[model samples]
Target: MSRLKLAICVLDDIQPLRRVGSMANDALVLLFMIAIVLVVMAVTLIGGFYLVKYLVERTFNS
Candidate 1:
């Protein structure tokens, strides 16, 4: 009976650690997604700026 109780206690202790590990993984995935979004936004902004500048110059010059 004491052995069973000890086993249960060990399991309980491990459960919280498992939850903490899962939370850490979720946080890492969120950070990765945010970084991807930032990179895409930066690329779009730079491309858009050049496109608009080219169009304006062409329209005015022609």
Candidate 2:
């Protein structure tokens, strides 16, 4: 019984460390997701700009 109580106390002490690791992982995942979103948005904007330029040039040349 004393061993079991000691084991539980040790686990309780370690729980906060595990939570800190989990929070760090969550923060990394969030940053990665934000980067992906920004990249996608930038690509879309650049593509749209080129598409518009191409159409305008074609209209004026034809």
Candidate 3:
């Protein structure tokens, strides 16, 4: 039937768009993971710096 052929063609045309949407979703997930890792690293570095400063001050002052 001509109508069935037309529907199949439309579905084929839209399949690439669906694939692109999934790819974008994957990229966003990866970006968020990288951001989280960077944030954690920054927090630990800052905390360690302050902790060392505290220990050094305590050792020399006392």
- Winning model by TM-score: 3
Model 2 TM-score (2 dp): 0.86
**Tens digit per residue, CA lDDT, model 2, 1-62:** 99999999999999999999999999999999999999999999999999999999999999
Q: List the residue pairs that clash in candidate 2.
A: none
Residue 58, candidate 1: Cα error in Å is: 1.7
Q: Residue 15 in model 3: shift from native, Å?
A: 0.8
Give lDDT for model 3: 1.00
Worst 10 residues of 1 by lDDT: 11-20
Task: Order the numbered candidates by TM-score, best leading.
Answer: 3, 1, 2
**lDDT, each prediction:** 1.00, 1.00, 1.00
What would the per-residue lDDT of candidate 1 be over residues 1-62, giving only the tens digit for each residue?
99999999999999999999999999999999999999999999999999999999999999
For candidate 3, lDDT tens digit of each residue in 1-62?
99999999999999999999999999999999999999999999999999999999999999
Clashing residue pairs in candidate 3 are none
In candidate 3 the C-alpha lDDT for residue 11 amounts to: 100
Model 1: CA > 4 A from native? none
Q: Which stretches of candidate 2 lie over 4 Å from their true place?
A: none
- Give the TM-score of each candidate: 0.88, 0.86, 0.93
- Candidate 1 displacement at residue 27 in angstroms: 0.9
Which of 2 and 3 is ahead in TM-score? Answer: 3
User: How well does model 1 score by local distance difference test?
Assistant: 1.00
